[model samples]
Target chain A: MSDMPSCQFESRPRRIVIGSSGVQTDFCSTCSVRPNSICSVIEPGDISRLSEVAVEAIVPPGRGFIEEGAPATDFFNVTSGTVKLFKALPDGRRQITGFAAPGHFLGLAVSDSYAFGAEAVDTVRVCRFSREKMTELLDDFPKLERRLLEEASNELVAAQNQMLLLGRKTARERVASFLLDQMQTGLLPGQDGNGGRLHLPMTRGDIADYLGLTIETVSRTLSWMRAQGMIEVGKGYAITIVSIAKLEVLAAGNG
Target chain B: MSDMPSCQFESRPRRIVIGSSGVQTDFCSTCSVRPNSICSVIEPGDISRLSEVAVEAIVPPGRGFIEEGAPATDFFNVTSGTVKLFKALPDGRRQITGFAAPGHFLGLAVSDSYAFGAEAVDTVRVCRFSREKMTELLDDFPKLERRLLEEASNELVAAQNQMLLLGRKTARERVASFLLDQMQTGLLPGQDGNGGRLHLPMTRGDIADYLGLTIETVSRTLSWMRAQGMIEVGKGYAITIVSIAKLEVLAAGNG
Candidate 1:
């Protein structure tokens, strides 16, 4: 287990998000989502200012946040739950384009309008900051600006990886990649690596939409994995990876 | 030409690299590269400091400027020519991930290292800035940080769109979309009121790599476009859009 680097974080970058109930504690400090989040990079001063300028908003499941051609309002950093960015074809076919976690930022646009729609996959919490306030922050802190730019570059890299998935990978390969990616992202809490178990967020349909396949295909692939004894699935999106070695092989396009 | 929006302007942002002698100009007013890039949301004061810290370097085609896992040293905004960012798979299958243009930033990463290598697609000129300088600039300039963040979001959008192409669209549709993306991105700069016309950088092989197809497929698709009178190919990489209406129709994944 130690052979695999701990990906325990990448979910909750920032701990502050106001729910209807009240302010949440600093869940980011020891939560599983801290390792790769920008929230970890924010200094005390930055966090203070961010808290001052940001608003916590609840995103109900299936609710729309940003849609294609909509004006860019506030940029969002998810604090909890999952979100999917997707596009619809002229024929009404839709593609789940990206999956955003708690630490990930969403709906940022250099142009005035967004080019994609951001929709919540589950009941989610997010930190929203005004574009203007963010601009002021950039002028005051060059390191933050650099960090944001670097973040953008990372986003592009991930996008390119997605392109490879869409362009080159087979359906089975895509499914394997998705499962591995979800596990490696480790946005959720609990499930200490007792026997290589993992958690999932979206359903079969969402996976199908993201991977450009049908729900049936997703089901078939999962069934195939089960038959191969590579994984054991339980209720509530729980998965025990019986063999990550084989899954990694599939993600490498060997499937 | 009068009808086409001219993106050219006097006094580009700034240069990141120190050496610019051999750097060819991409436009009359714009140097080979801009120092500040689109993320100039940072303050003029910070910009000046970063200008002192950045290093400029030039590389000919087929050479790499940044490797995938090396500590992030420099970031760049492309001034002239093309820079391709790509990820190398475990088995060494190169995924032509992205192509950077004039005024576009390069070597941007959220982490200390780049996920892909930056390779020159042409005799490229670049403005280089240290990541530390970028950090300072971003920390000081929230606007710049916001801009960079938004730009990254755009790249993510582009990647998702590319995913739709690779996963859902046919080879012909992929070619059409690539042509549209190239032309719209200003990679092909000279078109008149009649329609948008521009040059295509990289060969069919490059396009195939980017689009997740074989060179044979790319060439066949181009031939098919010509036979259908959708576009006219000229000397070098010049291409005239014989039918924008048909092109957009195909580009929307309708054809």
Candidate 2:
């Protein structure tokens, strides 16, 4: 259940607060994903209180932060990098349920055991909290609970969307939908001064796993899309959407 | 989008409290699904507080309780009967995401609009609450907030499981899994002196929609299972599981 054996970790003590006055350190105040995370729901003066219970940790590329079927102990908020959440069958077949970005919360479990495994797609930084401390924090801060409910509801919506995509969409539609979704999620990180471009941190195999397709099928679809001038594939995983409207049409299964 | 127009309702004063002291009336006190619902999180003496904000309503067979793209305003807890939740494409193609039973909560929209439509599969009883009042209730009781979080987490887990089913399972596997899930959800009811027998409230077309299959495929799969001595079908939708273990093996995709 644990993927830690395949990972190398660098551990360091993260300073939260200097004293018991709930004074936040510069690190907590300057966190890049602060505005997008559940921490945004905290009262201005309560960041230090939250920081006191959070430990900032780093996960190297391909390292797991949470393991499937393991005892659920901690909650994680991704501060940087991408992590794929997956569930594997006993025989080792895998289904990638979701890919979490910075500001996304992971490690939610229905029971005491984690339902999925999560591994960093790249070097990732996360704020980790023990389950007990998180519970106490939720009890102390009603706004945080409300924010959590909203996030959970959003995740449920996304999961339902994924169900529709998996169940109904054709291969071409699936690929188009995935590209559009990646664009919306900021996974594209368009540095070409054009927002239509995408930079995939995850590999083709990851895409295949996430989309329930074979690697060869995924590659074929991308090539076909490129041939049709719908998208341009750069070196490696870089992709630029050449025709957004056409891609949308394809994603809607009308093309 | 409201669906009340299609439903025939017999409205009456749902007396929640007898006096001014928030004493619960027999209606709320004897509600069968209370212990399994959000009301269970309320304090022992707070039933009247909740009941005051809740309106008990019945939805007749084939009537929708919640419609997709509707402005979100109310929350619902099913007290009896089955409700199917689904999303439809612009072209009228539909995919059912889930079915709600007694104690299941519906109408937790991610944004201001409902993402899916919900309809009664049979005569359904539900307790409806205005979103504003529910928010107030959650703020008044932290336990209820905690309980909602748990339910949302559970729903997320179920959604992930359905993702795996939709993305990876074959048609036969899908049918088998659906049957097992119905058994677990008490959809079978099993009041015919046989716990292994199932009474389906939803039609085969509903099953097809929920399983992402054609109605013919669902029927064919069921017939195949019957021929294999894995099940027995009576009049209409009654089904008796002849070998639950074998069915489970099929559900696991090993058959």
Candidate 3:
């Protein structure tokens, strides 16, 4: 692990070099997830103001960038790859709260310490902004605050849905709901609109933590779905939805 | 239920009049929860802008003010009493997401429909703001947007804590944690500086739903706590914390 903070870049500068005007503009200008991020609220002419404060960092797979209960000093905007956010008990039991895809923002706690920890599911790149700089940006760009409110509202809705899932949904229902949610978010790999193929990024243990179930239960539920012709458990991280209708029924708690 | 929306007043107008300038100013100026609410961001001189848009309504006990999946038309600021927010499954299962106390804000969702339902746990008073009027307020007062962001961040942290509780904590730990949280929030009624007495507004079923436990489990756990001399069950809807230190140990997962 790197000795620097989670938002600091590792000892690799060849992938994306910073500090040059041309490259700085190129980084934010042609970014894939910029339009869906909080940066979209900034006007085209004022894009430099965003690039001026954002320090791009690259995090390796399984590397934790944000530690739960640590001082929250930076805000992160994921540019690429997936990140898992989680909270752990003192006894070492952990609960995976949610996964952050590209365009997700992290470190929005009102308290001085982070409420959860974030780790990269794969090699991830994020634009790190110091709290002071982020506040300055919000001050300069009045629309940014409204944009953040919208972001927070959307997350709140998602959180409520997750609460329902964790509290009331059965093991089978939870897995089915998670699969459908991933498909709706377009997180599936090689999906051709109608294709049911999925390349899940997290492991069964991670799924168990998120769904408040055991890994054995998750595995058993998937096998049961496969037997019912609802899905196909492909090798490794691959899974195919054989029947969306059937999976929807299970996800809705009808099964 | 009144024919009007969830935020509309019943037949009573004698408690607080709205049309007159004197009453309007008095309503916002003397509001007990205003200082701790989102309206605090508005300047004292410009307080009239708020009074102009707000319409106070009284919700009776057990009455639902916000229906899940209904049109998201108004935002609410609880001025008095407790409210239970929840989401229900198709099979009639329900999960109480959280309880809103005085000064808590509701109805912040990006969707056109409310993500959760809210019912008055006691006789509740709330100030209602139409979505359009709220947009106008946000435009006129930029600080309001920041304040709402802060509110959302605080709620997000609470949601994360609830998630950890539901997914990982034992029944004993969950009840202990809930009691401690209530004490820390100072939500107890007639609470002196040293008193641990709590006048719980919600019923045992509400507590069960919130903690993701069945009523039997919640009851059994409370009995166990009482046996351990950690708490005292008084008459209807009353509980006294006999040993805060013991509850702290249980809440921290040491029990």
Candidate 4:
């Protein structure tokens, strides 16, 4: 067995504190999702140093956290709420690359400018760190660097998976795949109470952008799936899979 | 500025040597694309250590270097030739995620199994390292870790760009985008000589897979581009952009 340091991160609630910016901030100590984020890989002794450098901010729905083509100055970790990352063509056509949840990191880039725009699907909270300070922290903490690398790897994998979804899958397959993915990530409310019940934080247009389909096609496919007794939709946002096997078959493009 | 230790790796011609396993190996000292790869971020003193753990292998055309769902045992650095990375649905529908050129790294994953399959587009040479050994080396080399992180970030950007192509762009726009991308990467032949002349290393099927188009659609679009005086094709694999501005307009979805 390698002697590499490892941490098992889980989320819990805590209290908030004030920041250097004179605002009431949720310090690292109070971050319920710390263990579920890159911050979890750091030694407990380093938590104070991390909190000292982090700035907490809240974003209202429809507000952009990061704009595409802007200079990338900071890295963000979503502490709560959902954010959709997208790239827009000059003609206003948008393609959502991925969605960021509580544990997901945002704004890691290879170049000087952000490649995509990040917007809040709902009211969102994020911990922000300047790139310069974050690099220093990474240099000081090897475990943190490793954890960030792992996160980057995860992002790459997810991107490639989305490529498959966009490039090959049919509309029904895409929607089914998206539901299964959300279910696996526990993005659905009362997830444990149901088999494959899911709560979508994003809108139908958001889903259309994500799945590379028109909103009408997305709705039509969902309706068809419902007619086939494969899923049940509630309140236009909640989804219940009545037949997971069939859904999986469709997702695999074998149905 | 951070005082991170960095290396100036340069590839040179050298004879193969026998390793501890009694197998003839292409040592790191002779790698032709070392300076162009992530290895350049390591110190010169660490090159020998890296070579000691690496096994150089040659892959023939049509052979897979990495298979989806297989145990993720090794990481690869392409020293020569092009490789296509892809994911396949159960019914054999394939989505080509990205193509790897010389100096590109392959096989980084978030799970124990590879998320995609990598196949040689031509006769390919690669430097292979066990994942365990590479992780240890990463722990020992901070600059290398930073380099890997940067590569992963770059990959995410590329993947997102591809997502935009697959999701939002039309067939002509997709082909134009592909050409512009290759031109930007200097993957085109006579990149500095004449116009945007390209040498396609992969087949029409590969291009079709990458662009999420039927082979017929790809061929028809190429013909359309030619008729529009936007591009010129020669001897099948050679392409020259006759009108880059128009191509860019098409790529932006405004044509």
Runs with alpha carbons beyond 4 Å of true place in candidate 3: A1-9, A12-24, A186-195, B1-24, B185-195
- The i-RMS of candidate 2 is 1.4
lDDT for each residue of candidate 2 in A1-255, tens digit (9 for 90 to 100): 233434334553574545467755646677889899999988777777877888888888887768887889889999998999987655455678999999999876659989888888988888989999998998788888888888999999998888877877778888998988888665444343333778889988788888877788889999999999998999976888888787888887763
Name the regions of candidate 2 deviating beyond 4 angstroms: A1-26, A187-195, B1-26, B187-195
lDDT of 4 by residue, A97-186 (tens): 998999899988979899988888887888888999988898898788778889999988898889989999999889989888887664
CA-based DockQ, model 1: 0.42
- Model 4 residue B70 CA deviation in Å: 0.8
Cand. 2 Cα-lDDT: 0.81
Interface RMSD list for the candidates: 2.6, 1.4, 0.7, 0.8
Clashes of 1: 44
TM-score of each: 0.78, 0.90, 0.93, 0.89
lDDT of 4 at B94: 80
TM-score attained by model 1: 0.78
- Rank the candidate models, highest lDDT first: 3, 4, 2, 1
Going through the candidates in the order shown, the clash numbers are: 44, 1, 0, 0
Model 2, docking class: medium
True contacts kept of 4: 0.84
Q: lDDT by residue for model 4 over B188-240, one digit each (tens)?
A: 64465336788888888888899998888888899999999988988867888
Question: Which candidate wins on lDDT?
Answer: 3
TM-score value, chain A, candidate 3: 0.91
Candidate 1, A1-255: lDDT as tens digits: 002112122243434656577965443344344445555566754456656666667777766676767677667778788888877667656787788987887755667877777777788877777788876766666665565665667677677778777766777788888878877665246654533667677778778888888889989999898888878877887777777778888899775
Which residue ranges in model 1 land beyond 4 Å of their true spot?
Answer: A1-56, A129-151, A185-190, B1-32, B35-55, B130-147, B185-190
Q: Candidate 2's fnat? A: 0.59
Better of 2 and 4 by lDDT: 4
